[model samples]
Target: MPRRSRKPARPTACPCGTGLPYAECCGPFHTGAAKAPTAEALMRSRYSAFAVGDESYLLRTWHPGTRPERLGLGDDRRWTGLEILEVTGGSPLHTTGTVRFRADYADAEGPGSQAERSAFERIGPDWYYTDARHFTP
Candidate 1:
């Protein structure tokens, strides 16, 4: 019997609401073809990762100090969109930065949103997510 060959599916539009397809937007970053140059970009890619349940990409982009031993995504939750509210630093020359954004989703309970101010650090031309302070409203 011949073994079946598994092929990767084509990437669709980015869930971060960039309007561009995933291959043109965050896919490069997620696949290591490119790196996020700013905190805001990293935040967007991270959100996209969550929507697709890409735990490996999420952990790889997270700061080692804060990254958990493992990551799990709830199948019951469906991520819808992302809105970037604000950004500070995280530029090409900056070493640290913050991004404030809202991620919309729906779960077993109902539709809801998460607002967070995420911190990022630039280490040798790469941006890594450090932590976040979640907000309620």
Candidate 2:
């Protein structure tokens, strides 16, 4: 008898719009298996966290000075997509950076989007989300 090889499972698309598998793109960052290398990466991971309602990961990567004591990650909204509009600094050598983005969502009311230019700071080797300057949605 001949041996047969099992096919690998297909990967699910990451909600961050990276066109990559969730496991490869944001799963490691969410699970603490790996850290985001750049500020934009962190922002992408944060958006993914929101999409999946991983509040712990969101708080963990937030700047301690700004992190909320607790989160209410309810099921009222379903995060649909992310759009990275702009990026500044956020390199390995820079301590600060900004990422402008729009996060799309759908709720009982209807589909909507939130746009903001977010700031990030690097403390040691890890990047943390600082805050955002909101734009009219």
Candidate 3:
């Protein structure tokens, strides 16, 4: 897909490491227009959560117990890009899924980057991030 500029008319054009637009990208997933079918979709939604400060979405997608009671929105690093490295099958009803990704952004610390390998689980058609190894996710 062609890279989208963060233009206003295109709310989904956020190069926020989402790998897709706010509209066709995580927007649909966030607004209940769709459900993530794989670990890759979950990871992209997580990236979108960070982009728009939709901590609620993040929390909602997180598995219970590990789910935070609250999420404080604050200044955020400007996101640049998302590079999906890999994805693995979880299961039919519920399975263990894995995804690897690389993200770029700018922060007070300076231009920075994150590479993560994340895990997900599908429970009754809902996909949630189970754990994020500091190594990448």
Candidate 3: tens digits of C-alpha lDDT, residues 42-101: 888788777666777888999895778887766657666778887777545447788877
TM-score result, candidate 1: 0.90
Tell me the tens digit of each residue's lDDT in model 2 across 93-125: 999999999999999999999999999999999
- Candidate 1, run of 10 with poorest lDDT: 3-12
lDDT of each: 0.87, 0.90, 0.74
- The global Cα lDDT (0 to 1) of model 2 is 0.90
Residue 55, candidate 3: alpha-carbon lDDT: 71
Q: On TM-score, who's better, 1 or 3?
A: 1
Which pairs clash in model 2? none
RMSD of 3: 6.4
RMSD of each: 3.2, 7.3, 6.4
RMSD of 2: 7.3
Q: Candidate 2: where are CA atoms >4 Å away?
A: 1-11
Give per-residue CA lDDT, model 1, range 1-137, as digits (tens). Answer: 99743323435988889999999999998889999988888999999888877888899999988999888666778888898888999888899999989999999999999999999998898899999999974
